[model samples]
Target: MTLAKGCTLCYQGAKMVLFVTGRCRRSCWYCPLSSERKGKDVVFANERRIEAPEEAVSLAERMSALGTGITGGEPLLCIDRVNEYSKALKDHFGKEHHIHLYTAQAPTKPELEQLAGLVDEIRLHPPRECWDHITDTDYIASAKNAKEMGFDIGIEVPALPGLELLIPALPYLDFLNINELEWGETNAGEMRERGHELADGVHNAVSGARDWADELLNHGKVHWCASSFKDSVQLRERLKRIAENTARPFDEVTDDGTIVYGVLDLHPGTRDAVVARCRTFLTEDEFSDCGDRVETAWWLLEEYRDRIPGKKSVVERYPDGGMVVEVTPL
Candidate 1:
């Protein structure tokens, strides 16, 4: 059921936890989202925003979102906006809609009570340095509060290299999800300042991040899902969820920004089909990833779906407005 990477609602496709407000009360060095996007509560999920609550509901439905994980510079700051978005989604969709959120700010009794009606689950990201500061008293207090509200609460954090010292105290939290820490262009400067380096292979799941995840999983106090978590676990679980929750035909684009269907390699064809397709499904206004104006014909796809006698192909469109099909000749 996984549509594809970057596809809406697809696991690994668009786990766009809205970094609502970049403004955070605490400053962690490993903040990969970086400083530029902080406190700008304009609303963004994986570089895109649905804007209005009405539009967001429909947009999320179209993208086949199983659950909307509302995060933020700190979700609590914009709890009102997040609550609006969450409730709107449930209204457009239904109670079955799986809605989750991330936060560090422990909510008050009133906030928790209000959030209970909207969110299905919540994950907390307390800094690794702050792990010791959090104890059964504070951590469990928040967890119990959310749990009482019938929310599946858990903890998420980057697998900072040397945090095994804190692993033995797993009974403190019901579920702990460890993200393989990685550096991105947005946070490169901060990472360098913090003396973090990128690993040679992406599969390695950040340099020290993997090492910590392995260490945590061994104890079994909490379920420590790794970065290379199985495709069935990583992609299928949530995608199947989103797919089952909403209905939207997918149009996957490639890194080159071309769409493919049936291996037509329309990279060399008339722009008619491409333009028609986008105008029909994506939008009436023409758009191109090549930075060329919509009217520019020079970059018209010159590719086409290859046809062979006595063979069939699986047609797919690339994100770049081109086509691809996998088939066998018999």
Candidate 2:
């Protein structure tokens, strides 16, 4: 029911997602990146696309972020970018701003050493083919290297069948994260080809994925993240956290982390009259002029709808970022 430390911060909206790049050396069949991101060299801070490192910092400030998780198609491939952003966050927020990284690459000592001063944790994803015998891969050396260089080292992999091989290597790791296999727009075909199917009533999770995680929980170091938990708990909590920090005076934060507000679309000629009317009838704290529309609390607008002109709606949108979730036309 609860997430790991890094993931828990993420769920609480304290951890910002810093996607440095989408170029990876390994081709994991179950990667859930969307078509716009997979195999492409793009940078995103949560849902906002960005061109510079400072944009991520600005976005983090907007959400009152306490930490960041550096992810990518393969972050190590873009080591310089990782170094830049990681150092930037720590510089701006101070060292207590927890930062972690996810990579499939078995980085060298120099690369890890560069990250040690900025990154607090390093999670390695060895190829799925090596899941049955993790000790045989370069991940062992990389994990030990990360540990020695003062990073909280751990292994993160899909909770696929025959993952018991990773158990033997747990002694050298600080923690182990097993993610439930998932199907997405970009990886659906590959998932089906590998004999995975959606769990009944669950939209994207691979069937029987949770069962694979059960066999490993006795190890104490293992953290099993069910697909449902990621979709429902983690995402919602993050949204709520952002909503609390970023909601405008006229916006109402919902229990689910969405913001609910009333919008009145005004004609170019009638905008002046509407503004005058709003100013006369509503208190300064109750309304805001949002370019082409007037925004106010849903309940306040509903209480005085008869006095307001033009097409009106109660809109619910994702908190802090993302798009509109619902609009009730009035």
Candidate 3:
């Protein structure tokens, strides 16, 4: 099946996720937003928190992004923020940098007008209760309006029952994306309340979710995103891209996109002598002297383990000084 441009970029790990705000208007039972960002008014470029819209440009460049996906509590709720960031990206990356936005609210002429030149695509997420009567809601008109306004319009919804009811609205859409329904920390209780169980013991995918899309698969415009695929393929690809761009000469990039390096835990009393000793053997670029620790090539640290004076370990972590994944005492 042909993927949407945004989906294509995502599968290739070329799309940077730009989270503008965490303040969503609707509280969907299946919202997977983390607790740290669920209702907080925060902005994130992938995993890095930033204060300005322009910061997204640098982060996108770090991952060598070809496109970006704007998502939030609801992006339409803050049109100006959307406009600013989209404009910054387009200005820096040019018009060919594909941008798609996700919104639960249907856009009228005004909202579509604001997004007209900046956004390349718009994905509507009409609430499940309205799926059966989507034609009667503003969503259909929004889709039609969005299409006429030169934006590729589509509907994106979790793979759930009653999706077939959206058939009547299909003629107005460029595509339909059905995401595998999955358990989320915030909605796990609600999911259990609805009597849903994991499709398997391992992944968060809900049982029978894909069955809901069995008939829709035949349609050329329809696409199904499995939870496992998102977690394993899409995320791994994105991480690899980041690792390639951010990894230093001393850092070992793994297939999973994490970086491995040796760390020297320093004590206040012996920090200077240890650093002096390290400087004799390690080149200026071979190690980074963090306030409390020193990081260098894992093999270099291994070879000089007996010579250095502090606790030492091999550490694997996310790129760009991100969270540590593992630490083994050396």
Candidate 1 has its poorest 10 consecutive residues by lDDT at 296-305
Best of the candidates, TM-score = 3
Error in Å for residue 150 of model 2: 1.0
Best by lDDT: 3
lDDT of 3 at 100: 98
The total of clashing pairs for model 2 equals 0
TM-scores, one per candidate: 0.66, 0.95, 0.97
Model 1 over residues 104-193: C-alpha lDDT tens digits?
776666888879878877777766665665664455578778777777777777777655645643555556666667676566677777
lDDT of 1 at 64: 59
Compared with the true structure, all predictions reach lDDT values of 0.55, 0.85, 0.92
Model 1 vs truth, CA RMSD: 8.8
Model 2 Cα lDDT, one tens digit per residue, 1-330: 333467668667678889988898887878899988988999999888999989999988877889999998999888889989988899999998999999888878888878888888888988877777778778889888888888888889887887777888888888889988888898888887888888866557788887877767877788887778776887677788788778988888887788999988988999999988999878889898876999899888898889988889999999765789999997
Worst lDDT 10-window in candidate 2: 1-10
lDDT of 2 at 323: 82
TM accuracy, model 1 = 0.66
Write the residue-wise lDDT of candidate 3 on 108-146 in tens digits. Answer: 999999998899999999999998788999999999899
Whichever of 2 and 3 has more TM-score, that candidate is 3
Residue-pair clashes per candidate, as listed?
47, 0, 1
